[model samples]
Target chain A: MKGMTIIVKTISSWVKLLIFLFGIYIVLFGHLTPGGGFAGGVIIASSYVLLMLAFGREFVEKNLSLTASSRLDCVGALMFVAIALVGMFYGAASFFWNFIHQQYLADRATEFKLVSAGIIPLCNIAIGLKVGASLFLVIFALSVFCNDFRCKGSARELM
Target chain B: MSDIPLVLPAFVCIPLVAAFLLPILGSFGRKGRVVATALANLAALSLLAMSIASTNQFSVYNVGRWSIPLGINMVLDGFSALFLITVNLVSSAALLFSVRYMEQYTAKPKYLSLFMLMVAGMNGVVLTGDLFNLFVFLEVASIASYALVGFGCDDEQLEASFKYMVLGEVGSMFILLAIGLVYGATGMLNMAYISKAIQNNPTNVVLCFALALFIAGFGLKAALVPFHAWLPDAHSSAPAPISAMLSGILIKVLGVYALVRTIFSIFGISTTVGTLLVVLGVVNMVTGAFLAIGQGDLKRLLAYSSISQVGYIFLGIGLGGALLAAGASPVWASLAILGGLFHLLNHAVSKSLLFLTSGSVEMAAGTRQLDQLGGLAEKLPLTRASCAVASASIVGIPPFGGFWSKLILVIAAIGAGVYWAAALIVAVSVCTLIMYLKVHRYVFLGELSETRQQIKESRGSMAVAMICLACLCVFLGLVFLAPALRAELLEPAAKVLCDGVGYADKIMEFSKDMIVCAD
Candidate 1:
C-alpha cells in the first residue's frame, strides 16, 4: 500500500501530533477533568489510526512494531499492579490501597492539584498507556489482516 | 476470621498479575515457555491453597478501606468459599492439563494469559458483593471464554464463537438492564442495601420485573434448556482444557450460582420463583439427557451431560426454595439445599474430569467421534480408568460422589412430597447411566480400530491432572460420609441459602468492623 495524496498526508501529519498532545493532556488531567485513561487512550489510538490511514500500514509498522506495542501494553498493566502492591506494603494496606497522599509523603497534594488524589494520576497514566497500546495493536493487527483495504494500484492511479 | 477477608481481593489479583506477566515473559524465546509454565503453575497452586485455607470462614473486605454500602465490598461467606474452591481447583487442574495439551497450538503464552484472566474474572464474580461489579466480572470471564472458544480458528470454532458471543452479549444486556432497573428503583448498587430496600418495600412491580429479567438473563448465561443452543457447539470446538473450564465451573459460577444468589439472598425466595426454578430444572434435565443420547461427538456428549447435571443441582435448590416458601420445616429446606450444593461440588469435579478424558481421547485417537474411537481400554489405560471413574460418578453409581448427591436430592424431594420430581430425579440418573454406557460401548470397549492401533496413553501433566480429578471423584463422596468435613464445608454453604435474605443482615453486621472512610 502507498501513502495518500499530499494534501491529506500533510494535514494528517500535523493533526496527528496535536491529537497525541490532546490525548496526553486528557490523561494527565484526568483526575480533575472528565476524560481519564480510557477516553484519552482511545483518542491516542485514533491518532495512530489516522496516521495509518494517511501513510498506509507499512509506514506505521516501521515506526512501531507489533511486539513493541504488546510489550508496552504488558508493562503498563504491570506498573498499575505494582502501584497497587506498593500500597499493600505500606502498613499492610488493602489491595489497590492509595498511600501516595499519606502523611509520610513529605508534602501532601492539595485538592484540585495534578499531584493530589493519591494514586489516581499514576493509575490513570498506566491505564492510558495500556488501553492506547492495546487498541492500537488491535487496529494494527486487524488492518494487517484486512485484505479488502489493500491497494491493487499505485497511489497515482486512483488520484 | 478477622484477617481472612484481607485475602479476598488477592484471589482476583494473583491471577491478574500472572496474566499480564505471562505475555511479557513469553516475548523472550524458548526459555520463556518454561518460565511462563512455572509461573502459571505457581500461581494456580497458591490460589488453590488460599481457597482451601479460607474454607468455612466468612468476612467482608471493604475495597480501599471504604465503608460498606458506601464503597464496594468483597464477601467471603460460605457460598463464596464453596464456589471459590470449585473454581480454583478446576482452573488449576485445567492449567496443568493445558501445559501439555496446548503444546500443539501457537502462542502458549497468550492462552495461559487468557486462562488467568478468566480465572481472575471468575474469582471476582464469586467474591464481589456489588451488583454492577458482578456484571463487570461476568463480562471479563465471558470475553475470555469467547476468545478461547475461537482459539482454534477453524471454521467450526469460528462459527461457534460467533454464535456464543451473540447469545452471550444478549444475556449480558438483559442482566445489565435488570441491574439498571434495580438501581433505579432502590437507588443503591450494593447488594446488601438492595436487599434491605426490598425488605422495606417487598412488593414493587418494577423489582418483580427486574427479577424476571434476571432470571431470563442468568438462565441464558447458565444455558438452561431454552437458552442452551450454544453449549454443545462451543464446548466441543474449544481446545479441551478450555472446554473443561467452560463445562466445569464457568456456567456454575456465572449462571447457576449467580442466579441462585440473586433470587434467594438478594430478592428473597418465593413460592412462585421456587416453582419456576423447579419447572426449569425438570425441563433442562429431560432435554439435556435426551440431547446427550443423540450426540456422536464425544465432547459434545459430555457437554450435553453438563446441562443435565446442572439441572439436577438446580432441581435440588429449587425444591429447597419451594419448601421454604411453603413455610415448611427449615430442615427440609436446608437438606434440599445441601443436596444442591453438594451436587454442585460433585459435578464440578466429575464433569471437568470427563471433558479432560475426552481431550485425552481426542489427543491420542486423533478424533472425538465416538464411532471412530475404539478399545482405548488397552492403549490408554489411565485415561480409560479415569474416564470410567468420571462416568460412574456422573451416572450416580453407588459409592461415588454423584451417587451421594443424587441420593440426597431424591430423599429431599420425596420428603418435601414432590413425588414427581423425585421420580424424575431417579429416571434422569438412569438416563445418565445409559448415556455413559453408550460412551463406554462406542469409545472404550470395542476392539481397537485399525487406524488407531498405534495410539498411546497421554503422559506427564495431562495424565496427572486427570488422575487427580478422578481420585477426587471417588473420594469426594466421603465428604458426606465423613461428618467433620461435611459439617465444615458443605453444611455451612447450605446454611447460607437456608438463611436466605439473612445474608444481607450478616454482611451488614460484619461491615461495622471493616468499614474505613476514604479520605
Candidate 2:
C-alpha cells in the first residue's frame, strides 16, 4: 500500500510539473500571443488542485506547502513592483516603461524572443507568479480546513 | 485628452503600496490593523487632496515617459479627478468603518489589505489612459472583491463568492477579448491613440464588434438588467461595509466610469452607441427598481437600488452622447454629463451611508431581514437618523444631493429634445422613491420587534463613518449652487467628453511637448 501511494503521489507531482511548465510557456509568450499571466497562473493553480484531488490533502501538503506559495506570491509582487520602479530610475516617468536607448536591442527584439517588448514580458512573468502562488495559497488553505474537518468528524465517530 | 498629469499615477500607486505593506505587519495584531487603516486612510486623503488641488488642470502622466502609442499613461482631467475624489473619499470612510466593524472577522490585517487593493484597482481603472491597464485593474479590483465578499468563509459566503467569481471572470474575459480585438485592429492600447485610429478608420467591423463586447462586459460589471444575477447575491452576502462599498462605488467606478470613458473618450460617442446605452439604461432602470421593490433583504434591496441608480447615470450620459452626436448644443451635453457625474458622486455617498447604516443595524439587531426589523428609530437613534437621511437623499427629497442631480438630468434631457427619456428618468425616480419608502416602512417604522428590544446602536468607528457620509449627502447639493466649484471640477470634465474626437490630438500634443521640453 505504501509503494502504491508513493507511485500515485509521484504521478500527481509529474502532472503538476507538466501544468506548471505549460503555464510558464503561456506567460512567456503572453506579449506575442493570446495567453497571458492571468490564464497561465490559473492553469498552474488548477494543476495543484488536481493533484490535491488525486492524492489527498496530506500528500499534497507534504509536497506543496502554503508557506512556500505565500513566499512566492510576495516575491512575485515585489518583482513586479521593482520592475515598475525601474521606470522611475530610467527617467521613463512611470511604471512598466522599456528603457532601452539602443536600436540594436530594439531591432533584434523583433524576432520571437524573451527580451523583446522591454518590460511587458517581465511584467507578465511577475504577474503570472503572483497570481499562481496566491491562487495556490487560497486553494491549499481551504483544503487544509477541509482535512481538519474530516479528521475531527472521524475522531468524533471513534470516541 | 487633456494633458495627462503626474498626480493621476499617484492615485493608483499610493493604495497599492499600502496594500502591499499591510501583511508585513500582521504579527502585531491590533497595531497591524491600526497601521493598515492609517496608511489606507492617509493614501485616500492624499488622493482627495491631490484631486481637489488638480481640479482646474488636466494632466497626463506617460508611463515611462514614452510616447502615447508606445507606453501606458495615466490621465487626470476633471472627470478623472472627480472620480478620484469620490473613490478616495468613500474608501477612507469605509476603512474607518472597518476599523471597528472588522473585529468580528479573523485576520483583520488581510481584510484591510484586500480592501486597499480593491481601492487601488478601482483608482487605477479610473486613472489609466491605457485600455489594457483599465481591464487589468478591473480584474484586480474584481478578484480582491470576490475574496473580500467571501471573507466570512461560511457556506453562503463561499457560494456567493463562487457565483460572483464565475460572473466576474466571464466579464473580465469578455473585456480582455475586446481589448485584444482593439489592439489587433489599432495596434495601440492607449485610449487616445485608439480613438484616433478608430476616427481615422470609422468603418472597421472589428472595432464595432469590440465595442459590442465592451458594452456587454462593462454592462455586466455595472449589473445592468441582463447581467445582474451575481450582484444581489454577492452584495448581500458581503460584510455590510463591503456591501456598501460594492454597491456605492464599485459598480460605478468599474462599470459606469469605464463605459463612459470608452464610449466618449475612445469612440467619440456615435449615435448607435448612444442608442445602445440609452436602451440599456432604460432597461436597467425599470428592471432594477422593480426588483428592488420586491426584496425583503435590506442589503439586497440596496443592491438592486444600486442597479437602478446606475441606470439613471447611464441614461443621463447616454442621452448626452446621443444628443451630442445629433448636433445638439454643447451646453446641453455638458449639462447632461454634469448631471450624470453629480449623480455618481451623490449615489456613492448616499448608498454607502445606507449600507453603513445597514451594517450598524445588523450589528445591533443581528439580522438584516426587513420584516423582522422595526421601530429602530428609537432603539438606535443615530443609525435611524442616518438611514432616514440617506433614504431621503436617494428618494430625491428636496435639499438633498439626489434631488439636485435628478433635477439636472431631467432638465438636460428636456433641453436636448429627449422628452421621452426625461419622462423615463422621472418615472424611475418615482419608482426609486417608492422602494425606499418600503425600506423605511419595514426597516425603521412600525412597532418595535420584541426580540430587538435590547438592540443598541453600533459602537465606535461605524457611527462616525455613517455620520460623515450622511452629512456629505445632505450638503453635496452646494456643489452645483457654487459656480467656482462646479466650473473648476464638473465643467472641465464635461468639456473633455464634449471635445469628442479631438482627444487624440490633445494627448499627442501634450506628450510631444513634454518630450521636447525635456530635451
Candidate 3:
C-alpha cells in the first residue's frame, strides 16, 4: 500500500511539473501569442493549487511559504517598474518605449523573432512572476487561514 | 536628449524606484520609515521644481529618440504640468500627514513605498503621450491602490479591496480591449499617430465603439454615477492619506485625464460624444450629491462627494466639447475647459484636505461616525479649521477655489446656450452645500460628545499638512482674478483642446522640426 501511494504521489508531482513548465512557456511567449504574463502566471498558480489539492496544504507550504510568495510578488512588481524606467536611460521618451535591434524569420514566413525588441519580453516575465506569486499567496493564505488541520511529523509527510 | 528633461521624468522615476526599495528596507523598523519619508520628500521637491520651471515652456521627451510614431513620448504641456503640480503637491502633503498618522499601522515602510508607487503611477499617466502606456501606468497606480486599500487586512478592508480590485480590473480590461481595437484599426499606439490615423479615416462606427469603451473604462475609474459601486467601500476602507490620494488624484489622473486626452487630442470631439459626456456628467452630479447627504460615515460621505465633484469637472469639459462642436465662440469653449481643469485642481486640494482632516478626526476621536462625534472642534481646533475650509470650498462658497471654478463653469454653460446644464450645476451646488452643512453640524457644531471631550489635536505633521492645503484653498481662488496667469496656464491648455484636429498638424510639425535638427 505504501509503495502504491508513493508511485501515485510521484506521478501527480510529475503532472504538476509539466503544467508549471507549460505556464512558463505561456509567459515567455505572451508577446507573440494570446497568453501573456497574467494568464501564464495564473496557470502556474493553478498548477500549484492542483498539487496542494492532491497532496495537501502542508506540502505546498513547506515548498513555498505564503510570506515568501508575497515578498516575491512585490519583488516582481518592482522589477517590472524598473524595466519600464530603463527607457528613460536609453533616452526613449517615456516608460515602455520599445527599441528593436534586429528581426529574423525562421520555420515559416509567418514565424518571425527579434533579438532585442525593447522591454516587452522583460515586462512579460516580470508580470509573470508577479501574477504567479500573488495568486500563490492569495490561495495559500486562504487555505491556511480557513483550514482547521495542521501538518504533523516530517514536512514531506505533510504532503 | 542633451537637454535631458531630467526634472520631468524624475518626478515619476524617483517615487517609483523608492516604492520598490521601501519594502525591502522597511524590514529595519524606524530607520526604514525615516528613509521612506526622506525619499518621498525629495521626490516631491523635485516635482515642485520641475513644475515651476516648466510653467511657460512646453516640452516633449521622445523615449529612446525614436521620433513620434516609433517610440513612446512624454509631453509636458501646460495642462500636464498643472496636473503634475497638483499630484505632487497633494502627494507631498499626504506624505507629510502620514509621517505621523501611519504610526498606528505596523508596516510603515511598506505603506510609504506603496504610496510613492501610487504617485509615480498617477504622474506617469498624466505625462505619457502614448495610449497604451497610459493604460499600463493606470494599472500600476490602481493595483498599488488596491493593495493599499486592504493593507489593514481586516474583514471589511479585505472585502472592500476585493470588490475594488474586481471592478477596477474589469475596467482595466475594457481599456485594454479598446487599445487593441484602436491599434488594430489605426496601427499605431502613440496619441499623435492615432489622431492622424483617425483624421485620415473618420469612421463613425469605429469611433463610436472606441468612445463607448473609453467612457465605460474611464467612468469606472472616475467613479461616475453608473460605475461608482466600489468607490465608497474602497475609499472608506483605505488609510487616511491613501483615501485622500484616491479620491483626490488617482481618479482624475487615470480617468478624467485619459478621457479628455483621447476625446480632444485623439478623436477630436464629435457632437454625439459631447452629448454623451454631458448626460453622464449631470447624472453623476445629481446622484452623487443625493447619496452623499444620507451617509453617516465621514469617509464614506466624502467618497460620495468625490463623485459629485468629479461630475462638475466632467460637465464643464463635456459642455466645452458640445459648444465647440456647435461652433460657439472659442472664448466660451475655452472658458468651459478652463473651468473643468481648474475644478479638477480644486477638487484635488479640497477633497484631499477633507480626507486628511477626517483622518485627524478619526485619530483623535477614534470614530468617524457623524452622530457619535460632536463639539470637539474646540479640542481639535486645527482639524476643525481645516475641515471648515475644505467644506466651504467643496460646497462652492465664494472666495474659495471650488466656488470660482463652479461659477466659471456655470457662466460658460450659460454663454454656450446650454442653460439646462447651467441650471443643473447650480442645483447640484446647492445639494452639495446642504450635505456639507450636515457634516459641519453633526461633527463640529453640535454639543460635544463626552466620549470625545478628551480628544487631543492631531500630531505635528498632520496639522502642518492640513493647514498648508487650507492656505492653498484660499490662494487658488485668486488665480481666476489674475488674467495673465489664467491666460498663460488655463487658456493655453484649453486652446490645445479647442485646436481639435489641428493637434495632428502641430505634432507633425514639431516632430519634423526635431528630426531636421537631429539630422
- Model 1 chain B is weakest, by summed lDDT over 10 consecutive residues, at B510-519
Off by over 4 Å in 3: A1-159, B1-4
What does candidate 1's lDDT look like per residue over B1-519, in tens digits? 656766888999899999999999998987997899889999999999999998898888877766767788899888889999999999999999998999988888989999999999999999999999999999999999999999887679989999999999999999999999999999999999999999999999999999999999999989989999999999999999999999999999999989999999999999999989989999999999999999999999999999998899889999899899889988878899999999999999999999999999999988999888778889989998999999999898998999999999988988888899999999998999999999999988988878877878869999999999999999999999999899878998998888899999999987764444323
Model number with the top TM-score: 1
Can you give the TM-score per candidate against the true fold? 0.96, 0.86, 0.85
Candidate number with greatest lDDT: 1
The numbered model that scores best in DockQ is 1
Candidates 1 and 2 compared: the better one by DockQ is 1
Instruction: Flag clash pairs in model 3.
Output: A91-B64, A92-B63, A92-B64, A93-B62, A93-B63, A93-B64
Looking at model 2 chain B, report the run of 10 residues with the lowest lDDT sum: B1-10
**TM-score pick, better of 2 and 3:** 2
lDDT of 2 at B223: 93
Q: Write the per-residue lDDT of candidate 3 for residues A1-159, one digit (tens) a residue.
A: 012266667887889988999999998888787898999999999998877777787777779875567677878888877776766455434444453331222223443353234467778889999999989877776665554236423322212
Ranking of candidates on DockQ, top first: 1, 2, 3
Provide the RMSD of all predictions against the true structure, rounded to 1 decimal: 3.4, 4.9, 5.2
Pairs that collide, model 2:
A92-B64, A92-B65, A94-B64, B3-B59, B3-B60, B4-B59, B4-B60, B5-B59, B5-B60
Docking class of 3: acceptable
What interface Cα RMSD is found for model 1? 5.7
